[model samples]
Target: MLYQLRNAGFTLVELIIVIVLLSIMSIATFSYLGFGAQIFSDVVGRDQLISQSRFAVERLTRELRNSLPGSARVINNNRCLELLPIHASSSYLELPQPGQTNADFVAVPPDNYSQGVNYEGTYLFVYANSEQRIYNSTTQRKVISGVTEQDSTLIFDYNTTPTLFPLQSPAQRYFISTGPVSWCLEATGEIAGQQQLVRITGYPLANSPDLAHGDAQRAVMASDLYNNIEGGQLPFFTIAATLQRANLVEIDLRFARRQGAEPFIIHHEVHIPNVP
Candidate 1:
């Protein structure tokens, strides 16, 4: 048992080998984790973009659907989509058309009508066939001067003295609107190299869409749009109604995280089912 006592520890060569192995393992583990984290980050970014696009599209579609018939029009060279949202609609029992002295009409009260609800400043539209009649002609649009409920029917008086309407709805349907609403895609004034989608409200109804009106209320609906207008690409396209098809609104939006990020494009088609 008289053997020389050896050091009860690893040799220098053994320790060096163990250290090298640990270094390799650590490098590989961190690399894998870093790659997974990058993937997660990318997925999250994409999801957020999708959610924003979905909400904007859905809200725009809802308003278009509830708009007055034949009231959807694209102006500013397809940069803006203008619509007159209907507050209420009803079937009329009598309408004061052209050459009528009395500018009063009787209609069945709308389902949403409530007591003491003022109808002043609300416009009455009947048989609006084209964009011209809806926005340009005064006869086709009349402001409600008074509203009175009597025996389950409502009487609506017009501000116009004679109420010379150019056309009448064959279905006898009347649409009420407060004013025009517009969705416009424009360059962001504050943020450089980015575009913004904005909604214009309270602007005086005009024959053309006003991108900048001093009295209009503007709100940004979405940001980070990358639409290429100079390259013949527009955010909105209006397919006119034909005998074989109804009117269609094509919405093409391209979004990105930033200016140089990958673009996420969304295409939506909204059909106008309500015709004049």
Candidate 2:
């Protein structure tokens, strides 16, 4: 019996069979490990994209909500938004008219006016290529820029007839000019081939005929302003804006994630006030 066992152990064919089985197992294990690493990397990349998108949206929403309505004007042939805030006497101001570099303007206090008057306004300038900027009315210095471009829109001009107020009640207050403003922006490159789109709409301010209000205020009121003016089945993210008060605006942003093996989306809403 001992001799038979020794012969069985010494068989070269049996040893070769065991070696082949072990090799196959090692290959299979390595392959599985490699696959797992790939999946983990993909997941991390997707998460980073989602986080960046969310952060960009949130920052934009905040800036929009604080935008000043009266000071908001279209620039670059109605491709950008230039905003100026109200200013108090004794403050330094700058105005950027078409074809003009920062023209300086000083605020003079109304004669015989009492003190403690709030004389300041928020200024904003929005443009394509995912650029949103804020400026100080007094210093004429840039406050912020490059908020986020991952997904954004440039709203040009909008149409709406001025709302008429009762003659005996009060003067008609204008919020945002009503009408359709051409909105444009580039979607993410990764999803560019997938036909991604962004939908934008404006909400009329309460009792005001103007279209958008303060960025933050409008954002709050713009929650339900999406009407889908353009018809299509493309994957879309929605943005809405409305004027809440004379010096306040609100903005709403929603990132609609596409289904399938795609990155998740981040949604945001913010209110801004005192923007010119």
Question: lDDT scores for all predictions?
Answer: 0.83, 0.32
The alpha-carbon deviation from the true structure for residue 232 of candidate 2, after best TM-score superposition, in angstroms, is 5.2
For 183-241, candidate 2 gives per-residue lDDT tens digits of 22323346422322232334322212233334312212111111222342221232323
So what's the TM-score on candidate 2? Answer: 0.38
TM-score, one value per model: 0.84, 0.38
- What TM-score should be assigned to candidate 1? 0.84
Error of 2 at 43 (Å): 3.3
Q: Candidate 2 — which residues are off by over 4 angstroms? A: 1-12, 70-184, 187-260, 274-276
Candidate 1 lDDT, 1-276, residue by residue in tens: 697977688989999999999999999999999999999998998888788888889999999878886778888877789989989988988887667775668898888999878999888888775687889888778888889988888998776634666677888888889999999888886656578888889888879656577788988888888888778668888776665777788899989885738888889999876666
Runs in model 1 deviating more than 4 A are: 1-31, 189-193
Report the poorest 10 consecutive residues by lDDT, candidate 1: 158-167
